[model samples]
Every structure is written in C-alpha cells, then in structure tokens.
Target: MSRSLVIAPQWIGDAVMTQPLLRRLHARGERLTVGAVPWVAPVYRAMPQVEQVLEFPFQHGGLQWGARRRLGRELHGRFDTAYVLPNSLKSALLPFLASIPRRVGYLGEARVGLLTHRLKNPQDKPPMVAFYSALSGEREGLEQDRPVLRLDAREIDAALAAQGLRRGGYLVFAPGAEYGSSKRWPVEHYAALAASLQQPVLLLGSGKDTPVCEAIAAAAPNCRNLAGHTSLAQAFALIAAARAVVSNDSGLMHVAAAFGVPQVALFGSSSPLHTPPLNDAARVVWLKDDPGYQPPLDCAPCFARECPLGHHRCLRDVRPERVAGLVQGAVSSA
Candidate 1:
C-alpha cells in the first residue's frame, strides 16, 4: 500500500480546493493522511479519501520552528512520501525534518533544498483545483472532479436547530473575503440585494466580518447576520442546505460549490482565472475593467487586501442592481 501525507493549505478556500488531489491519490489506492491547522482540518476530515487528520497548531507566518521539529519527530518514518501543498518554506520543513524519503511540491519560496521531487509551477496559473492536482500527475478529468464534503446529517440538522435555521428555501450571502476589503463587494450593496429579495437571507462571515454583517442585517430586515458566531463546520452545514449562495470569493463560496449549491460569485482584487470555482453550478461575475468609467479600471485585481489606490472601483462599480438581478434569477429558477 502506498502511504502518503499531505501538508494542507492554510486558507480554508485553498484547503477545500485540495480535495481533487486527495481524490486522485485515493483513486490510485494510496492511503492518505493530512496535516493542517485547526481552522482547516475539518475540511480534510470530512473527505473520505483522507485516512487521518493531524492538527498543526502553529499560527500563520510564525516560524514555530520548535513546534514543527517536535511534530516532525513524532511523524518520522510514518509515511513513504509527503506532498507539500503550500509554497512557503515553512510548509516543507516538517517533511524535511521527518525524513520522508520522497517530498514533492512546486519549487517556490526559494526552498529548493527542502524538496526531493521539485516541480515547477506552471506559468499559466490554472484554476486552483487544477494547480493543486498537478502534483498528483493526473491533469485530465480534474476539472470534472469537483470538491466534495461529507458532513454528518445529524450534525447538520442540530446546527440548523441551534442557529434557528432550516434546510432549503433560504438564500445565503457571504459578503466577507478574508483576502481583504478589495475582494469584498460593498456591504451596502449586499444590503440592497437583501432588500430586493423576499427570501430569508443568512449573512455569513468570520469574526472580522461581524461589523459589516451587522450593517447589512440592520439595513435589510429580512437578513440575519450569523457572522462570527458559527463555527466552520456549522457554516458548511448551512451552505450545504442553502437554496442559493451569493458571495465574494472566499472559503464559503468554495464550500457552496462543493455542495453543488447554485452560486453567484463576485470577483474583485483577485482573478477568477486563478481561483475559479470548480463547480459548473457557479456563475462568476467578474467586472474588473469597465470601459469609459470615471476611474480607470485598468489597474484592477491588484491582489491587494486594501485598494492601493484608495478606490475600489473594481468592486464598488459593480452596482447592487446587477448582483440583485442574478440573485433574483437564481431564486426564481430554484
């Protein structure tokens, strides 16, 4: 039996995108284990392809060399090969210290010496699912293999009860993008969209989004702000049962895609070419450059958290009415 370990991505969206790689490995009859942070571990744990999930408690960008070394020691000789998913130098440290014979990953962060099977990242910058599955040497049929999450039905039902929510007939709005404000559509726009629709709205986001969600909920009486209150697992269950999702490019957007929920995704400060949703059910609305506009949209998708130029025309210009039209259509069709 082929035994392998994968060092998962730090971001929840990226973690969900890694499922295609897991499925490929599983198809080859490999026994896979995942190493991930607490925030992302549940994603992998829900995948049947993963044999085990190891929690890595280190904070982002913090070296925590000692912790990595200790964990590496504990993991020594347990796997024959390791797949380093993150490009950061630190992402490869554990496998290096663990003495895994075969380490595979893109040659990034100038950490050349750490990996034995160093692969070059393609210059084309394919969608995230394709980018991740490239390491598995199976590029064909990847686009068709959408990310899948298997959550306990009982847990999902319990979470809905706790949130005073029910399955089906409700619309979900994810207005926060952890990437930065640049990626987020204006909260006022979300509020306007909420007001336009008659269906109940569940506004979702992390603690960072509570204020924005509150503003949206306040503006639209039909919207309920659940940002910062629900755990990631609960959020998954909620998205799984949503009638349709309207969101910025974020983790939950990917989650909705995984569950085959029809979604209207807004892209700003990021390129859909880089992280487009794998599910065909999603409709991407990318309006980075609108010709003849007052502010030249030529410099959009700066990929910055905050708009460097102090104007987020990339998102701000894509008015609420446009998005509301799409949502109305989705709801009506559903």
Candidate 2:
C-alpha cells in the first residue's frame, strides 16, 4: 500500500477545501497523513480517510529551522510522496528535509528544487475548490464533490449542552474574518438580521470575535455570543446541528458547508468565484455583485486586509434585510 503525506493549509477554509484532494487520493488506495497546525488539525482528524495528523508547532510566518529539521528526521522515509500545499518556501522544508523521494507542489517562493513534480499555478486562479481538487488530477466532479466530515452524535449533543443550546433551537452566525474587517459585515446588520429571524442566534468564532459578537448579542434579543468559548471540534458540532447558519466568508462558513447545513454565506472584498462554499446547501450572496450594488468595480475584490479606499461599501451596502430574507428562505426550506 502506498502512503502519502499532505502539507495542509493554515486557514480553516483552505483546509476544508483540501478535503476533495484528500478524497481523490484515498480513492487511489493511498493511506494519507496530514501535517497541520493545532487549530486546523481537528479537520484532518475528523476525516476517516486520513490515517494520521502531524502537528506543525511553528507560528504563522515563523520559520524555526531547528524544530523543522528534527521533525523532518522523525518523518524520514515514512511516505512515498509528499504533496506540499502551502506556497511559502518554509512549507516545503519538512518534506524536502525528510528525503521524501517524490515531492509534488506548485512552484512557489523560489521552491523549484524542493519539489520534484512542480505544478504551475493556473493564470485564471479558479475557485479554490477546483484549484485544490485539480492538484490530485481528478477535476471532473468539482461541483459535485463536497467536503465531507463525520461528526460524533454524542459529541454534538455534548457541545450543544455546554453552550446551553439545543439542536434546531438557534441560528448560527459567524461574523468574524481573519482576513480583515473589510470582509466582515457590520455588527448593526447582524443585529438587525438576528432580530428579524426571531430565532436565537449563536455567534461563533475565535476569541478575537468576542467583542463584536457580544455587541450583536446585546443589540438583538435571544442572541448568545459563544465566540472563543468552544473548541474547533465543538464549533463543528454546533454548526452541524444548527437550524441554519448565516456566516461571513470565513472558515466556519466552510465548516457549515461540510455538514451540508443550509447556510446564507455573505461575501465582500473577496470574490465568491475564488473561494465559494462547495455544498449545494449554501446560498452565497456576494454583495459587490448583487443587484442594486453600485460600488466601483475596481474597488471590489481588493482582497486587502483593510479597504484601502476606507469606504467599506462592499459589506456595508449589503443590508441586513437582504441577508435576513436569504436566511429566512433557507430556514423555511430546511
């Protein structure tokens, strides 16, 4: 049996998108091992197709040479092929140092020699789902191939109980984006949406989102801010059991899609064409492209950390009423 090692992406959305590639590898009868950060490791662990998950302890953008060398030694000769996913030069160091004979990856950051079979990044930059899936050489079922995860029912129940929540009792809202505030919808809009839905809203995100979540909870009755309170595993369970999820273009949005949960995904600054949710159950509303949206075409998809122009109309113009309408439709159908 052949064994493969995959260097997982750092972002949750990217990690989730990689599932299709993993599935493709599994279909080829390869046993898979994934290297991922602590926060994103749960995703790989939840995949039944994955045989092992190795934790990458280095901080983001930090290159710890000694630690990487030691880890490389430990992983030496364990895999027949290693698919390096991240574009940074450091991302290839472990697999290269481990002496994995066949390393495949995109030619990134002058990493020409590190990978034996280097794939060129397409000029068009297709949707991330398609982009990652193509790396495995099976690109035909792009739309039909959704990220699938097996959640423990008991664990889901426990997560709900811990949050004083019950299955189908609330709407899940993820309002934070690690990318930047430009990608986040206004708190007022989220509050308005919560009030309109009449269902309790459970705000989900990392601890960084707590203040904003708390503000929204305060503005809307029956809303609870659980940001930073739950582990990634618990967050997955909560999202799996949600009545419906209304989320920004963030990692949890992809998590909701993985469960095939009905969701209203809000997008701004970033184009849905690049990193859209893969499941049919998701309704993506890209504000800049929506009807009645009149922002300068150039201003959109800046993909900037913060709007350089300082006017975040891409997100602000997408009214709560529009989002609420979508959520209501999704919930009713669900």
Candidate 3:
C-alpha cells in the first residue's frame, strides 16, 4: 500500500481546483491524508480519498514555525510520499520536516533541493485547475479537462431550505475577492445585474464583504444578502443549487465551476489567462485597455493590494449592463 499525503492550498478557490487531483489519488486506493488550514478542512472532510484531515494552525504568521514542527512530529514516518500544491518556499518546509521521502511539487523559488520529484511548471497553462491536475498523474498528459467537486445532496437541500431558494431557478451573486480590491468588480454593477435577473438573487460573500452585499441587495428589490451568515461549506452548497452564478474573479467563482454551475465572471487587473474558471459553463468578461481612457498613472494588473495610482478605472469602466447581459445569457442558455 502506497501511503500518501497532500498539502492542500489555503485559498478556497485553489482548494476547489485541487479536488480533481484528490479524486484521482483516491481512485488509486492509496492510504491518503491531507494537511490543510482549519478553515479549509471542512471542504475536504467528506472526500473519501482523504484518510485523515490534519489541521495546521496557520492564519497567523507567527504560529507557522511551531505548527510545522508539530505536524512534522505527528506525521513522521506515516506517509511514503507527500504532494504540495501551493508554490511557496514555506509550504515546502513542513513535509521536509516530516521526513517524507518523496515530496512532489512544481519547481519554483529555487526549492529544487527540497522537493524529490520537482516537476517543471507548465508553459502557457490553459487554466489554473488544469495546471494543478497535471501534478497528480505519471503520464504527464493532462489527465482530465473538467474539474470535479462532490457536494452532498443533503447539504444542498438544507442550504436551499435555509435560504428559501426556489426549486428550479435562482441567480447567485458573489461580489468579493480575498486577493485585493483590484480583483473585485464594482458592487453597483453587481446590483444592476441583479436587478436584471429573471430570478431572485442570493448575494454571497464573507463578513468583510457584507457592506458591499448590503448595498447590492438594497438596490435590487429581489436580491437578498446572505453574506457572513453561511459557513464556507454552506456557501458552496448554496452556489451548487443556483441556476447561474454572477461573480467577480474569486473563490466562489471557482466553487461555482466545481459544481458545474453556469457562471459569468468579471475580471479586472487580474489575467484570466493564468486562472480562468475551469468550468465549461463559465464565461469571463474583462476590459481591453484603451489608450485614450487611461484613468490612473500606475501600471494596471500590478497585482497589488491598493491601486498604485489611487484611482481605479480598470474596474470602474466596466458597465453594469455589460455584466447583466452576460449573466442573463448564461442563465438563459442553462
């Protein structure tokens, strides 16, 4: 029996994208374990591939050293191989400390010595999910084109009942991104889209996004703010039940893809080429730079927390009608 461990990515979107790899590993019938942050543990709790879900105290930077040591001690001599999905120097430290013989990960940050099987990162990756799926199999060819996420039917039913979602149709709007304001679509644009939807809209986000959700809900009479009320699992459950999801490029967009829900994703400052949603039922809308309409002096897509130029035109220029049209088309086609 080949005993294996996978260190899951911290972001919800990345976690969802890693599901296909986990499923492939599970199908091999290996003794598999997953090391993940506490918040992300629930997402994989029900995955049959995971023999155990190990939690690491992560959120705070200070606890990482101690957590790595503790995890290394607890999992020492337990797994024959460990696969790390996140491409961070710090992520490599734990499995190495745990003394796992074969640590597999992409070649990045000059961690060649740290990883036993260091796969070269793919050139011009098709999608983020596709890129991650390549890490699992030996064939080196893309194992699968579609990303898969397994959601319990009971959980879906419960979320539907709790949210008072109609049986056949509803629209979901996720208006937050953890990366930064640069990745977020304008909330008013979301409100305009919600107003145009034929079905009632359910706003999804975390506590930090409540204010934005509230503003959209207030603007659209049929919209309801469900942010900050549901757990991460519940949020996915709700998304799974919706007819279509209109979102910014965020974790929920990835969750929507996992569920195979129709989605219209708005992008600004972030490149869809690097991390496009991995669902066939999804479409991405982005702004093409116009020389005459430059709103800020800073480089757009700088991938920064706050816009370097102070004014944010990359996101602001995208109209609400454009997003609404895309969402409407997606829902109608589905």
- Candidate 3 local distance difference test against the native: 0.79
Go through the candidates in order and give the clash count of each. Answer: 0, 0, 0
Clashing pairs in 3: none
User: Considering TM-score, where higher is better, how would the candidates rank from best to worst?
Assistant: 2, 1, 3
Candidate 2, residues 240-310, lDDT tens digits: the string is 99989998899999999888888999888888888887767778887667666564556778889898888
Per-candidate TM-score against the hidden true structure: 0.94, 0.96, 0.88
Q: Write the per-residue lDDT of candidate 3 for residues 145-261, one digit (tens) a residue.
A: 545677779988998888777555688889988888888877778877777765688899899999989998888898889899999888888888888898888888888887779
Task: Give the 10-residue window scoring lowest on summed lDDT in candidate 1.
Answer: 288-297
Q: What is the lDDT of candidate 1?
A: 0.87
Error of 2 at 177 (Å): 0.2
Error of 2 at 54 (Å): 1.2
TM accuracy, model 2: 0.96
Question: Arrange candidates by lDDT, highest first: which order?
Answer: 2, 1, 3
Over 4 Å off, model 2: 295-298
Q: lDDT of all predictions, in order shown?
A: 0.87, 0.88, 0.79
| C-alpha lDDT (0 to 100) for residue 258 of candidate 1 | 85
Report lDDT (Cα) of residue 21, candidate 3.
79
Model 1, 1-334: lDDT tens digits are 9899999999999999999899999999889999999999989977889999998978888789999999999999999999999999999999999999999999998889999998888777678888888889775886666788888899789888987778886889999888888888998899988888778999988899999999999999999999989888888888888889999999988888888788899998898878877666777787754555664667866788899989787888877788878766665664
